[model samples]
Target: MTNIPEGKQMEAAIQNSFNEAKKLYEKHGIDVDDVLEQLSRIKISLHCWQGDDVRGFLNKGRELGGGIAVTGSYPGRASTPEQLRDDIDKAFELIPGRHKVNLHAIYADTDERVDLDELAPKHFENWVKWAKQKGYGLDFNPTCFSHEKASDGFTLSHPDAEVRQFWIDHCKASRKIGEYFGRELGQPCVTNIWIPDGYKDAPIDRLSPRVRLMEALDEIFSDPIDEAFNIDAVESKLFGIGSESYVVGSHEFYMGYALSRRKTVCFDSGHFHPTETISNKLSSWLLFGERLLLHVSRPVRWDSDHVVTMDDELLDIARELVRGKLLEKTHIGLDFFDGSINHVAAWVIGTRNTLKALLRAMLEPVDRLKEIELQGDYTSRLALVEEFKSYPFGAIWDYYCRNAGTPVREEWLAEVKRHEREVLCKRSQGEGSVV
Candidate 1:
């Protein structure tokens, strides 16, 4: 029961623990070194909205509409593109492994008064340059919410043909931006389209809006961008703040549309009913589609988009990806905004939890477990599964973080606090506050 020492002694203890954990995993025929290497190669896209509370630079001072809201007055919300990028830089330093930045169309860095429909690759030149300099890949999305056009809780599915065309043009422009990101970065950029279009009350005609949505999406993807550069994905939601009754792009709608149109379907963890989980749908979707995009989020009561944690569902999702061998075909991205806490800490926590879950899944003796299941030894399978839960996963994770030169365990939180004192607290309330 010796107390753990400070400084140099702590490093030695962590290494000793990792050494013991490595041997324990080797007994189960798992290669700890290979698992760490695999985890290093996996990239999770960190959402930019988390740094700015979803208040994109293009629409400053506008109330967040279309069922979207960021609830918290936490200081140091990045107000400008430069500030947001700086904040993201701080977050990346605390988070291990190389990752990409996910951006909404409204985060366009140009100074010109360009609307969403007028967005071009040139507008995001600064983001591209920043990403290239940091050696990071990039992902793009067309923001269909928080605009006057979406005031009535609709965009692509809006009845007005003119309004529908406006969204269509914006999405088309967004694809071009995605293509530019991939071409410049030499990695395919997933351009995901998620529109908040549904009725708060039961609509007399639910079919029409979906029909319009289908048609609009058809027109939007009519000009096919090369898949090598830009990969298109359609995301669906169960319900949103304003649209609680009937969501036009329901799961079934997107599944039908994506499969029929040969496009990727995005499954948002927070977009499903409380009783349903995206972890169960990966195998089914991968059976038909070539690829899938995942918006890893935590939904408390509904689509709240809370920060992700290493909860049971997160572990199950990671297991499905590893067991089904769907990692290569799935694009992982964080999709939560918590203005209630330190924004950088939120990013570090969520991203690190996701990575830890993946590492845990990878360390499992899957072959042995599967063999037992096939041999009708259900008892042994269940026993092994439960027994492995108490394994020295933390030691391996600490080793990974230390090896990657990032903070180990809870060490990253101290860095977040120092940044808050030296940087975040200095921003004016007006600059940090969100509507």
Candidate 2:
């Protein structure tokens, strides 16, 4: 049984997540299965609301024989444990005993939140305890300080060292908070690190004090925290609010590559474009730069975090990553956020659809791939995806879609909404909202 969500434990980290994540890809055990599961859960939350509405979407997702793999108290430092649990409970009232949550948030803007210290630690601890009693895991996201702190969407980690240390203090307190929550709750927790400290001038010869920033995080987890906290390194793409020209790539790429091996490249699918590599076949532009080796997967539609489109080109690349065992070698997060669609329905469908597409991608051919390319023929592998006879990274989406009953739209939000309306409405008749 999983305990209920409360305070920052529920707000920052959910309960019993990795076990459910492991269970999701159990039958396949095929690396990318985990990728698909990760993407699907992200969709549920993206399509839902920042509060109770998302839990409602998750309530529907659990009934479908899957649960949300990535989610959170959302709306950043503003959420309280009580606010978060309100949403988690509504999810259960819909499906009863079927559901789970993993707390992972993007960058936090201080202007939007009250104060970091204002975070209710005890309430967060109780949520962790309750979630553990029920059987679940928790996760948190913290940002590394960089020069990008003065922006509109940047976290306060930037600014001045004193201000940065304030965040460092938050990290230390968060460790104690996480430790207390995990000790009392009986679940694993994770911390997601996405630093916005990159160069705007492109020629970044001088690597800033990023090492010190990450070291600050090390200080947080260095203590006796019982829960297994994962540090997911985010690969940022494009220039938007608080844009950073550089971000983490491969699992063992720079950053903590030399010291702690706890970091994992949480590739956001949107990097499939000029930012990261997704398709080796679509590497028409790859030869220009040797760095294409670390390209993250994405749809061909130019940097859009579409969340669902299954272009054969993008799937081929992500599949190769999985087939080469890259996907399994580290901790993975779906790495998606709301771009346009604010409604929960649009978000979940796109996420769920990507989940299905990723499953198809895992079946793509990769072993004889480089050799097959030299031969200048695509017939052999093409035959596999079209026929569904090949192993992971083979087989077309059409084949798998039939089995998952996934929707045919560009994103899965429509299908996610359909499920919520059809199934969740009846369940929520007498229950309160989870957020």
Q: Top model by lDDT, which number?
A: 1
- Which parts of model 1 are misplaced by more than 4 Å? 1-6, 429-435
Error of 2 at 269 (Å): 2.6
Q: Per-residue error at 345 for model 2, in Å?
A: 2.1
Q: What overall lDDT, based on C-alpha atoms, would model 2 receive against the true structure?
A: 0.39
Q: Candidate 1's residue-wise lDDT over 77-132, tens digit each?
A: 88899999998998899888999999999899988998899999999999999999
Cα RMSD for candidate 1?
2.4
| Root-mean-square deviation (CA) per prediction | 2.4, 13.1
TM per model? Answer: 0.97, 0.53
User: After aligning candidate 2 to the native by TM-score, how far in Å is the CA of 186 from where it should be?
Assistant: 5.2
Model 2: ten consecutive residues of lowest lDDT: 58-67
